[model samples]
Each structure stands twice: as C-alpha cells, then as structure tokens.
Target: MSGIILHHYATSPFSEKVRIAFGIKKLAWQSVDIPPVMPKPDLMPLTGGYRKTPVLQIGADIFCDTQLILRELERRHPTPTFYPGLARGLAEGVAFWADHQLFGAAVAIAFGAFGDKLPDAFLEDRSKFSGRNIDRARLKQQAAVMQGPLRAHLGWIEDALADNRAFLFGDAPSLADLAVYHCVWFVRERARSDALADYAGLNAWADRMKAFGHGERSDLDAKAAVAAARAAQPAPVRGTVMPNALGLTAGAMVSVTPDDTGRDPTVGELVALDAQSVTIRRSAPEVGEVHVHFPRAGFILVPAKA
Candidate 1:
C-alpha cells in the first residue's frame, strides 16, 4: 500500500543487489522482511507461488525476480541509469556473468568457509532448509571445483577494470557494478575472505559501490512484515480487460500466479491478456484483497477448464 514495499531477508545476496540499487536511485521504500526459509504464509497471498527472495511490491502490484525488479526501477527512474545507452548490452552481459558464474562460485566459497559459523537464529529462520545441513567438507570440495572457473572469470574482470573506466562499463556505475558488489560483499561479510584484495581494480570498484550506502534499509522482523502485509488492503481491481500475451482468450478463468518458491501468486479472471503477462483479480480472500499480476513468460496461467 506504500510507494514501494520490498519483501526480503538480510544476508540475501540478491536482496542486497536491490538495496544497493535503491540507494543509488535515492528512493524511499518500505521494508518487509520475509522468512529466510519456507512456510511464507504472509507472502503467499501476494505472489501466489513464486518464492524467490527480495520481491518488490507496489500497491497491489508485485514484481518477482531481481532482474525484473531492476528493470522496473530503471523504467521509473532513468537519471542514474543502470544501463547507459550503448553500454546497456555490455552491462547486461556482465550482470549475467556475475549472477550466474560469479555468484555460483561465491556461494560455494561462502558455505565452505562459514557453514558452521552461520548464526543459529539465521539457520532457524530457514525452516525449509534447516534439515538439509551443508556438509562443509563436501562444500570445500565443491569450492575447489568452482575456484578455477571463478578465478578465470575474475581475471577477465580484472583486465576489464585495468582499462581505468571507473565502473565495469566506464565513468558511471551500472547494473554490472551492483551485481558484482553483492557477490564481493558475500565473500567479505560471510566468507571473510580477502581473496579479492589481490584484484586492486575490482577492490576499488567494490569500495565505490559501498560508498552508495544501503539506502533507507531498516531491520524488520519477518513476523512484523507478515503482519503489515496482512493488515494492508488489496488494491482495487480494475475492470479493464488485460492484454493477452499467453495466447489465452478473454473470459478464460485462469489463475495468474507466480512460479512456486513461496512468494504470493496473483490469480484472477483471464480478461484481455497477452504472451508477456496476465492480470487477475482477488475474487476470494485466499488471494487477498488485491489485483494480481504474472509474467506470462515465467508463470503458467492454466485455463480453468484444464
């Protein structure tokens, strides 16, 4: 019901990415700290099924996935652009490498080094992942396997930085910088490893991103966030037909929900829709008092007849 509501937990690398973006954009947003693990009852009513971390909620509109969220933010505020014109493609390429490749290796190292040291409180919050304890020894072995690939990637990043562009693309900070920051922050905060210190340019870039400061980030308990979400009224459902990008016909009673992870899924009567996204209304309290949205690309709006 506020300007921006972010449902996320502390120490989530992806969440941190959005936090940094908010800081860079200088936007004030509400914080809704979701459970680190499963049984996210409060969040479910909004996302329907998608459970990925760091969901962005605006009024009744919920945006899942950090990439999509970032895109929305960019569309809203274009000044400090994350994708600066010609560099957009390059920035996206770097972000992809960082999210997939770099994050893969960073996570491997983090669990390998701090699996045991992880706070009991944090571990307990992850009820879903609680029983599946990490085998540090195995994690270490996995780290070894990942290390070579990560190091090679870092070396490539280092060479890019050697060009003295300030940011990965040059001059101003971009999405690539934020993606890289979260991974490096994970290594420093969780892993406590200075392995990246050897990469001077990368280190310097990290420092620059850090200078942005995590804007308006205040701690909120998961229960509190859930309570706030429950108390909040769902946005009014507009009667206009939604565009159909999913090849569904108007009047098709399909459930427009996010993909399962734990996040709330948006469900409604399939009105005007498209292959990209679908709009739904909360006809039942189970779906909450809000209009729900789903990306046709990622969700399945199964026709009620099926």
Candidate 2:
C-alpha cells in the first residue's frame, strides 16, 4: 500500500479535483468511500468533529480541505509538479478564485437544474451543511440568478485559452486547471447541464482536462482505515510555529474551523503552525493520537474554549 487513503464519495467535486491530481502524478492510492451526507462514524475518529468530504489520510496524519490536501500531495510527490514553471503563487491564486466564486456559481446552476430530483434527506443535509435553505424552489431561483455569473467565469477561462495554451498556466495542467475543471465537471457530469454550449476554447480545455483520468485506485473498508490509523503514529512535527497574532504556542489547546460552510470545529493540541498550514494533535479511543492538518487561508484558528 502507498499508505495514501482518501476518504471521499464518488460524485464529490472536490474529491474529483484531488483524483485528477493523482492522475497527473500517476500515484497509487487506497480509497475509502464515505457517506455523501452525515453520520461519518468511521471518519470522526480521524477528524474529530470536522465533517468535510475528501479528507486525505497518510498513516496517522489527516489532511482536511482540498487546498491543503493538494499542497501536501505536491510536497510528498514533486516529480510532476502541480505548479509548473514555479507558478505556485499564481496557480494558487487562480485556484482560490475557482474554488470559491466559480464553484459557488457552478453548484448553484447545477442544483437549480436538478434539485427537484434530489431526495429530501440529501437536500436537508446540504441545507444544514451550507447554512442555507436548499430546497428545490430555492435552488431553482438561485440557479437562474447564477447563470450569468457562471457564464462570466467560463468566459474568463475562454479568454485565458485564447492563445491556445494547453493548460491554464502553460502546456502542463497546473493546479489552476484542476481547480477549474472540477466545477465544470460538476456542472456537466453531475448536474447533466452545460453552463455554456459554445465556448469553443473552454469546451476544448475541458475535454483535455477530462482526459486525465483518476490514477490507480483500490478499495479499502472504512473499518480497515480506522484500524490503520490505530496501528500507526503521527509523523514528528516538521516545522516550528511561526509568529502569529494569536500568540498561540506549541501544546496550546486550540480549535480549527472552516470560515465557510461545514463549519464544525476540530479541537486538538497545537502541534505546528505556519503561514501555509496548521497542524494539531488529537486522540480518539478508536484512532489514538492523530495529527489533523488544515490550510490556513480558508480556516479560522483560535484558542479552544473550555
């Protein structure tokens, strides 16, 4: 086993982003299918209360959020770099735009088209997860409003590819391409609707991205994943805590929460902190001591309350 286990569902857009990256890197990994909605009993032991899709597990280390997950993947396997031509900063900026704004528009368009067909339980779960009323009627209304935004975002992509570049940054698909592709994939593959029918440039780029199929994967039981964590120990902390406004120190009790949807908090002893990411050590009876990592940009970190 490569010891790389991904906890995600099949249709998850974020999961698709990571899956395509795995394809780009040509990596072999273990897959642990997780519930699309809630009651992720096997996952709780690794992530505490942070209920998010597509958590990346490496031995006893848990990486939450796709941003950090992709970064970690690059750190581990840098042969086929995600940031070609040292475009890390620019690629990450593009990823941020696609992940937030473009994703919001794409998902709205998707739900608007198919929300009526979704089960009540899935709708309810999504509403709770996003802290919004996610009913069919609301989705239909939002979808109509989001069409222009989605079109505009796709227009940007079309403009970028005007020169006939193979990928967003260059001839190679950078993280930017993966980030944009997943939202587009959700709209077409999951929602069964294309945002725009005739963006020649954007359509061609999408076709190229789709060709990078997910790399080698094998299924593993959820129970077996929990057991793997229990059998291992977290890697030694790698970096010192960078100076921060919070004055948090190593071993301080702290909690990390998403600033956006799915805002559940994960509390642990502060183990590492840097400009790029944060790590904390937490223990569960089932998984023992595990280090959970989160990207610093879209997450809120603070001293854990009593």
Candidate 3:
C-alpha cells in the first residue's frame, strides 16, 4: 500500500477536498471508512479527540484538518504542486476563506434544502457536532436566508473563471480550487440543488474539477489502519517551535482544539511547531505513539489545564 490511509466517510465535503487533491497528485491511497457522526472509536486513538472527517493518516503520523493535510501531501509529493503560480501563503489564504466562509454558506443552503429528509441520527449528531440545534425547520429557514450569501460567494468563483482559465490560479488546480470544489460539490452533488446553475463558467470549471476523479482508491479495514499505526513509528520531529506569544516549547503538555465546531481538545506533549502547523505527540494502546498535526489557523493551542 502507499501508506496514505484516509479515515473519512464517503459523503464528507472536507474528505472530498483531499480526495480530489489525491486525484490531482495521482497517488494511490488506502481508504478507512469512518462514521459520519460521533463515537468514532477507531479514530480516537489516532487523533486523541479531534473529531473531524477525512483525517489523513500516514503511518503513525496523523494529520488533522484539510488545511494542513494538503500541505503535508504537497510536501511529500511536489510534482503536481497545489500552489501553481501563486505564493504558497496566498493560495492557502484563499483556501481558508473557501473552507470557512464559503463552506458555511453552502452547508446552510444544503441542509436547508434537504435537512428535513435526513435521518434523525444524522440530525442529532450534527447538532452535537456543531454545538447547535439541528432542527429541520430552523435549517430550512437558514437555508432560505443563506441562498443570497451562497450565490454571492459562488459569484466570486464565477468572476475568477471569467478569464476561462483551466483552474482557480491558472493552468493547474491549486489548493484554492480543491477547497472551493468540496463546498460546491456538497451543494450540487449531495444536496442536488441548482445553486450553481446561473454560473455557466463556474459550472464549466466544476466539470473540469469533477473530471479529476479521486485517484486510485482501495478499501482497507479500519482495524488494519490502526494496526498499521501501531506497527510504524512517527517520522522524527524536525525544527524548533517558532517563538510565539504563548511561549509554547517542545515536550510541554498542551492541548489543540478547533476554534469552530467540534471543539474537542486533543491534549499531548508538543512535538513540532512552525508558522503554518503544529504537531503533538499522543499515545494510546490502540495506535501506540502517534504524532498528530493541526494547522495553526482556526485552532486554539494553549498550555493544558491542570
């Protein structure tokens, strides 16, 4: 196997981002289908408590959040760069906007359209996951309210593609393209909406993005994925913690939690830190010692509470 094992469910929008990136890189990866809701027993040992879809697991190194995951992938496979013609930070910034702002609008619209038909389990799970009530009636109202914002957000993409470039940045698909694609994919593919029907250029771009496909995928049992982590060691931590206001140092106990939804903290000994990402060493019998990485933005890191 290629050692790239992704623990993600089929319909996850964030997972779709990494999958399409995998397609862009044309790399073979192993798939570990995880639950769409809570109680991800197999994933907890690897991630500690970060409960998000589509975590990228390479050996004992666990990458949380698509922001850092795509960066890690690019670091490992540089041939088809995700930055393309733009600066890495600029490309990543656009991706951050698409992931949070655009995705929020898209989700509201999606759930608004079909939230009533979804199973109670999913609704209940999302309520807990997002730290809000997932009422279908409320969602339908929010979806109605979100239509304008969603269209406005997609309008930016439409204008970007007005030049008829192949991808967001230029000839090749960049991180921005992948980030934007997943939200649009969620709206159109999962929700089956006509949200993008007005944007001919955007739809054309979506067609090209869809053509990438999800690379070569083969299923691997979740148990085997845990075993793979147990059998291998995390790549040695490199570099020093960038001097920060937090005064965080290597080997200190710290906790990393998402600033947005699913705010479960993963406490561990800090391993590596830099401007873009943070790594912590966490251990459980299920996966032994694993290094979990999260992006700096959208995550709050602090000294673990005593």
Candidate 4:
C-alpha cells in the first residue's frame, strides 16, 4: 500500500505549503496532480463536494484541508515539529493569518499586479476552463481588494521581524514561519514586484526559508499524474476508521472524491466509520474506489435520508 498520496496541482499555494512541509520532514510520498479548475470526476468520489486543492490520501483514508493534513503529518513524523513548544500558540495564530489574511492578499496581487507576468502558456493552460476571461477579471478585482489589506499586514509583519528572532518565534522555524514564507513566496514569484522590498527583515526571512527546497518537486504533467492514478488499482479499504476524536461516522454512505479536474466516480456508499472520518466505496467503474474518508469536523455528512 502507498504510504501517502497527495492529490494537488503545481501552482496551488496551499499545495505549496504541504509540499514544503514534506521537504521539512524529508518524507517521500506519491504525488497525484489534480487539475487547477473544475470537472474533477476522479477526485469527487474521494472528497464528495469539497473542491479544494491538495487532498491527501492514505490507503483508503482521504484527508482534505491543509491544516488537518499538517497535523496528521506532524503526528506521523515528530521530528522537525511544525508546532514548536514555546511558540505553539504564536505559530497557530500566524498560520491562521497566513491561510486567511495573507493568502487573500496574495491572491489579489496575483490577479491584479502580476497577471501579465504569468507566461502566456500558463494563461493558455488555464484558459481551458470555461469563462476564463471572466474569471481573470474577477481575480483582478480580488487582487485590488487584497492589496490594501496585504500592505497593512506587511507593515505589521515588518515589526514582527524587527524582534531580531531568526523566525517568527525565535531561532527555530515554526508553522508560522513556513506559512508566512509560502505566502511571501507566492507574491514574489507570481507578482514579480517589490511590494515587500521595503521590509529588509522580511526579505531576509524569505530568503532563509527558500533555502529549504520543497522536496522532490519536479514538473509532472497533470494529465500524466491523473493517468497513473487511473491505471493504478485503488488501494484496499482498511477497516479502521479515522479516530472518533477526528469526528467521522460509520454507516453513513458518502462518495469520497477529489474536487479538481478528473472524472472517476460520482457516488459511493460510505461504510466503515469513526468519529474522525467515514469510508466510501464507489460502484462506478470510472470511480471504482474504496474507503474514501472525510474528516468529520471539516466535512458535513448528512445521513442518507430514506
């Protein structure tokens, strides 16, 4: 059985976060490249309706959301902890800000200031999605709104950097540092502007984090990855359920699937259960899958009404 399979796309910022974590932990994992847009047939059976990037699959168990995935990775591998003891609370706060606030700002800038900088090929690739032009316009508007908040947030981050700590919390890098680093990386790489140039400390911090190369990151075509996943047999469903503490149930029928661009299955019968996750078995040949699980807390599971 594969240890852990990550379904994600290259340009996804959230996926970048998990990729970096994999690098930090020095762990090897199977990579499943999902589409950047919708029409995700193969993935939906695993995720049900959640159409987010970067879903982690372990055997029959599927994990969505980067935050939960991070915790799971930490639990599986304790060394190089993302949540250092002294700065745990601070780290959590920073991560929250990055995922919501910083990411929001970065998205705005990505669509507004740096849209042209993206290679024509990149744009063309994304153009495959319906209503590409409309999406671009909306993204630009989002960028404009994000710019103001991001600038203010950057100012605050500058002051935080002034504390002379090697990281957000001290000499050691914490989840906060990584969260901040990836958001900044997206801005710098995608925006290609000096929006943050004025913040010397922030620049230095970003440079330091860059030294930790995301592990085994290579350009694998999205189509190829999907094909490989299709060719490979769905891993057997383990009877074990994600712990109840995680908040999933047994007997609830659900179709475990991903949310990106792949078609495998539409629905499945959710069987094996626990507090944390529920297992889904797909009948569709294209979606023939087993033990698709979702985190109880992050996902909504409505009992199949008779």
What is the TM-score of each predicted model, taking all chains together? 0.78, 0.98, 0.98, 0.73
lDDT of 1: 0.70
* True-structure Cα RMSD, model 1: 4.3
Q: Write the per-residue lDDT of candidate 2 for residues 175-253, one digit (tens) a residue.
A: 9999999999999888988667778888889889888889899999999999999999998889988889999999999
Local accuracy by lDDT, each model: 0.70, 0.92, 0.92, 0.66
Which 10-residue window of candidate 4 scores lowest in summed lDDT? Answer: 257-266
Off by over 4 Å in 1: 118-134, 218-246, 250-287, 291-305
For model 3 the local lDDT of residue 185 reads 95
Q: What value does the lDDT take at residue 39 in candidate 4?
A: 66
Q: Write the per-residue lDDT of candidate 4 for residues 1-306, one digit (tens) a residue.
A: 446678888778888888888888888777778766666767765555556778887654566677668877887888888877677767767787787778867867866776746665556655553224435546677776777788888777778889877777777777887788778878887567677778898898888777776766444443444444444555555566454543545544544432322222224565666654455655334434444445444344544434
Give the CA lDDT, 0 to 100, for residue 245 in model 4: 46
Give me the runs in candidate 3 sitting further than 4 Å from their true place.
none
Model 1 lDDT per residue over 169-190, tens place: 7788898888888888888776
Where is model 2 more than 4 Å wrong at Cα? Answer: none
TM-score-best of 2 and 4: 2
Which candidate would rank higher by TM-score, 3 or 4? 3
